[model samples]
Target: MVLEREILPYFQWLLGGEGLGLGALPQFGLVMLGLALLALIGSYLFAAARYGPLGGGDLVFQTVSSGFREMWEISPRRIWALARLAVKEAWRRRVVVALLVFFVILLFASWFLRTDHQDPAKLYISFVSTATTYLVLGIALLLSAFSLPSDFKTKTIYTVVTKPVRAGEIILGRIIGFSLVGTALLAVMALCSYVFVNRSLDHSHQVEEQSLRHDSLGGEVLGYQGRTTLDASHRHDVQLNNENNGQALGNHGHSHSITARGDGHVVSAAEGIMRARVPRWGKLKFKDRQGVEKELGVNVGNEWTYRSFIEGNTQGAAIWTFEEINESLDPAGEGLKIGLIVRVFRTHKGIIGEAIGGAFQVRNPETGVQSELTFFDAQDAKISEITIPRKLVGTDNSELDLFKDLASNGRLEIVVQCLQRGQYFGFAQPDCYLRLPEGSATWNYVKVYLSIWVQMVIVTSIGVAASAVLSGPVAMMLTVSFVVLGFFREFFVGVATGTEYGGGPVESLVRLITQMNVISPLEAGASTSLIKGVDAVLQSLMLSVAQVLPDFSAFSTANFAAFGFSVPTDRVLQDLTTCLAYVAGLAVIGYFLLRTREVAK
Candidate 1:
């Protein structure tokens, strides 16, 4: 005869390991593609610098060079001349300078803010950028509009015009001058800000380092320990036999116990009569057969069987065990210990294990005592157990990473058995420290400054172009109106009150203004169904008149940058083209108006 050895079953999981299917490349490529495009444009512009117009380069330089022209020949001069003029003028303009200085201070102070917080830089950037743009645009517009107009009023243009200078060239020169002054001030501010931000980062890094050091000290000097105690409220409910899984009474006066016998057999003690059924293989037996009895609220299913061990009359609290299985009579008609199945139940307050499923054997080194126990999952209708069984041995197994996979399972949690449980859940503390940077790289700050500068230039251009065509006071009024419109124009409409289709109440007019261009033909058609009461007025305007506004929200990217949302590059290009086209068209109209009008006395 051959020897029969124990065999361990290995389950081959059919799950496919996580693999890449090319989804990652698209996201990564998009950012790389954008940076590539930016680089290409920069290179192209740099290469074409010696060529004709560097886009709109002539405007401001011409304005300043014309100021010193001899009224005879229109010849070229170094561009830096106008740049110098702007700085001198900006220095004299205390109002604008004060605002710029204040904003610079704010920028520097922003570095001190808690950068570790989510989106703080984004919020700070958006607010500061928008405000800085307004300031720069206002000052630039005021300077540019008054630049030539003031000369015209003083009749200084006649002298300058009679010289070699052209009117266009003069306007260009003034723009260049102001841009230079603005650029220098911006450069200084950027340097300071970049220094501050780097210093802040250094300080943050130092603090983190010190915190790690302190954690090491804490771990070494003041030993710590911890424990996970199950609250009495969320205890386990169980029984000893196969009948009482669901019908077990809640918090009744009853208890059950299980004991291990010397013959490697488990004896369950309950209040039911000791009955045994013979199985095909063996006869069932218990150490104490007289303890088995039935009490109250007994129910059984295939999964669980037990005596209704807890009495219905008893109160306060109690626990029990249960099982669910029947044994068949053998050929010899002898009682057998086979066919017993273990089941666990959840009570309203505690969990009960009827027949212990499997025993986790543990030994205490100090006492030299061994114990066998079975764990249950639920104690009440709502409660669930979070138990982890660990077998302790001589050497510490805590550092070993075995059984980590079992910990991830929802019900079958695994935890290490430690000599001392204190190290189980302790969090290390940190230290306090600061550090500073020692360099002059300020590219980010410069970019912020440049972005603000360009936006202001655009805004001032709009206002100046208007002022160039209108009378002084009218120009001022128009400038202020447009500026106000830029910031608060949404208030004039009712869409600010609610959504067009009552999707929800609008938080503010600003959100409504931003959505002005989100037009869909289907939406236009859908508007008819939204005709109800006073809201109908809003619907009508949204479907018709409000479409004419510049969608000041379209010009805004606050939500995109501040809220960490996508702003499609195509949309940026489209909106930028639209705004430029509109500005140009408006300026043309104003030019015609100016050309036809004679100066009033």
Candidate 2:
């Protein structure tokens, strides 16, 4: 799904040892060792060329050995003192200006943000998350990139370097101090954003039984109006089910599904405007057009290559096997709530927004009895839900308990198939799942913010490391360039691995010059061969570069929070580990650069 070729290179490298019980630490250690060896070899060659072979050996060894020893010789007192100095300098430089700017942006955001969107909660969360990320990153980059360079320009770095502080200590102190300030700023901004969103979205409408129009059966209400108004321009139209429990819709672009309270007449809307389902993920299998069972669906025409599609009107079907059925987990007891976000590709559109029909089937594994397929109209590119009842009558007119009779050894199998002749259903693993009860939105919000902080840590560390060797402007430029490159690291890897079209950078340039498309083969000639050769070299270099850069996309949890999904613990740990590894490598590089630099000179 999602073009594993593009994203999996990094994930595979990082998570490969997950099953080996080593985690990413072993892979990280190996990489660090390789870098260390490369640096040592480069140093040896340079020394040998500059000085007669053996003359610079002692110099190289001393530098390497001393740097290694000095890494552990850090004094907490000296580091703390430098940290305090760094904080004081940051204050003097008016770093608080960034925080003030953040507040101003947040205060004026309501004027620009559309609160009447269909999912205003998603919009608000996305806006706040994006805005906070950009602001925090900007502040981190500025403070970290300019601090040491500014000190060097004013010859103030000599005051600290002259003391008993190691070069490593200076780097560490600066990182910690700057990170502390950034973290504090982020925490404050996050809290304010949370409060702002809550206040803006806090709304309720009055529902009276007399205002509702009942159906002929008198069990359901058709069109019901709420008395209370919201947002100055909108009122709610409430719809009640047979038990007088259902949903209410607001004209200003929001709706709420309700549940029955103590009495059937007394109903209340579900808690929280932003809520997500905790899914009991099941293992997926497939049946091909030949009715042969397979592990996955056939890949359809998608340039991005993210999802697989099941052929409609064919024997092809996607089956999900679920185990460990715990009825206690579900308070409804009505059935299993299944949520789906299916993408439809219509070969022929009879009418616009015309839904393709699909069917869901439940089979009894022990008795070989199956229920008649329940038909549902499938809308493309939107979330839809269905309920599978705990009790159902089989084809033989025998009643089956879903948990006791149909399910074998706590396992239940569900089959999904498209019924339309030409329409197709495209989906990935996460497209469909069982909808469990919602978790705390506030906790999810905090998790996303934490992810942003991890990103800040990475940017700040790289900035400080660059500043150790380069001048102020150059260091800033370098750090910024690395950040931009990190954002597209996966793309670079794709090109390098030949997964992306046009081969690599050189081939891409040639294609652009020659007005050739990606699918078109390069003409056979000396020029084409030369271009291909150069691209191979470039791809090698790009691959090496990608290995060192952080996978910035992995640290992004905005989508998860905005879409109301809990950020998985495994994902969080993976990103944090990757960030720390990059920081460690940068720290070592900074130490070496600072140790060799003649600051006083």
Candidate 3:
């Protein structure tokens, strides 16, 4: 329900842009600039009306222009001085008290969070990440919003304003100072949370040779009943290959894969399960029922609309084209490791937990040679790994070298399809990728925190900007409102565009008044037309607002860390750019707002 109410709308907007071949960034920028200009004009008009001609438009322009120039020429010393004062002010307001609350939560979390269920590691990671995010964000908002307003209330602002200080400098000081505080808080919390999770789930079990029995054919020692020695808390049942070595494997909740050492036995812990994976993303292509190459498949009955599903028992197929293949990249020498997260949508439940059958095939474009279809049983909502061997022997017992024969100019195609009738396989662009080993899990963990820091910066900047024109409590409320609304911007867009079940706000109100069902068409009448007209107007306004607000959910990287996936460099860069753009815009708005304020008066 939250996905539909919040996440679905933003994704729907993205899909709409993709379908229409429109660039989202340019459109977003234009809308944002337009809104900014409108706000500037509205502020100018209000100032003119309140302060009369001399103190109105002319005074506002003078103040803004002078403040802008002064801001540009402001010395680092002034900014730092104000920053230090802000830090002291935050301490005066007892912001560190929030950190104490965070500590208490971390200490008591073990009692409430059930680790006996599936994927305790994932649950722990999710809990810590969510807790730290909310706690840090709240503290940042409070500091940014109240610092300046508190100064105004105590007449301390007058002392700063009357000096050689510009309003923009004050804003910059608040943002930088509060950000430092937030950074410190977040750093401590992240470290503590990580340590807490690691210590809490620090479990290990010893495997003995007596517990393992040798298989006749493979000559490999297999653990008893596919399980190993049980510890007091938990036990690992690691699978071994023909060489009697444990293979790398993962479950939904793990932050990394677990592997056994020589002799098919090793001590395993939560920390041992984590290892960094580097993914080689490939370009995806789809073939329609008519076998024509297409960009993507048609959407199934999914409300999220993020992934497209190919019909089962049909000619439709999703193909991934991988390039730059070499033996060096495949360190294991066993084959190429492809990680896939496929969503299975079953039309009928044959049996609960019964995996559906899927097929993966490797084909050569130039030689028309293809490998045997690799059949794998895929569970719904789980990631499956399939390894493609370097050599594919044909039915005639002829060996086809994967890199030498199948690869066309070092390019290979892997096709995915659903083998079962009435069962669909859903995939997005990010669902499947080649797992290229990279940095450790600890390094990737740091990157996730960096993404959260970017979000905190944005919130702090907005809070400071709001305080430029609003009272302390009002500014805090406004900042909090922005966060809540930004998180659900897509939901507002859906309502405005009649994409939600109840249609636009006005139409929903009308339906409520007339006791009409949401799905049914309205009866033909003057009232219906009037209601529709009002709805159209309201939708247009809401749409304009939605276009300007940043989608806060886009900054979250908790899922990536929780699922043992590396946060891509491109994603981190994109988030940083987005944060900077918003901060710049808000800084400009704050400058103009603070310039017109009568701080000295």
* Predictions in order: lDDT: 0.36, 0.76, 0.75
Error of 3 at 530 (Å): 3.0
Model 1: ten consecutive residues of lowest lDDT: 426-435
State the RMSD for candidate 1. 26.0
**Which candidate model has the greater TM-score, 1 or 3?**
3
| lDDT accuracy of residue 269 in candidate 3 | 58
Backbone Cα, N, C clashes tallied per candidate: 72, 0, 1
Candidate 2 clashes between residue pairs 3 or more apart in a chain or in different chains? none
What is the per-residue lDDT of model 2 for residues 1-601, given as tens digits with 9 covering 90 to 100?
A: 1213222334554656445444366767877888899888887788778886787687789999998898788888887877788788778888788778878988898888776675677788888888889889988899999998888889988888777778888998898888888898899989988888777766655566566666544653453433333442355667766566767653443465655566434334423466544555676778888889987777767764466788899998888777776576457778878877778887888467667899878875556668778888886766676888888887778787777776756777778899888778887766777778766778888888999999999999999999998887898898888888888887878998999877889889878987889888988999889988998898898887776887776678887766667766666666777777777788888988887688764
Per-residue error (Å), model 2, residue 240:
3.9
For model 1, state the Cα shift of residue 48 in Å. Answer: 48
Best by TM-score: 2
The predictions' CA RMSDs to the true structure, in order, are 26.0, 4.2, 4.8
Per-residue CA lDDT of candidate 3, range 70-153, in tens? 767977888899888888887888888988999999889998987665667667878998898888889888888887788888
Candidate 3 Cα outliers beyond 4 Å, as residue runs? 1-32, 47-57, 208-211, 217-226, 231-234, 238-266, 283-300, 310-316, 324-328, 331-334, 347-354, 394-397, 512-515
Q: Order the numbered candidates by lDDT, best leading.
A: 2, 3, 1
Candidate 2 overall lDDT versus native: 0.76
Listed in order, each prediction's TM-score against the native is: 0.36, 0.87, 0.86
Q: What is the lDDT of residue 355 in candidate 3?
A: 80
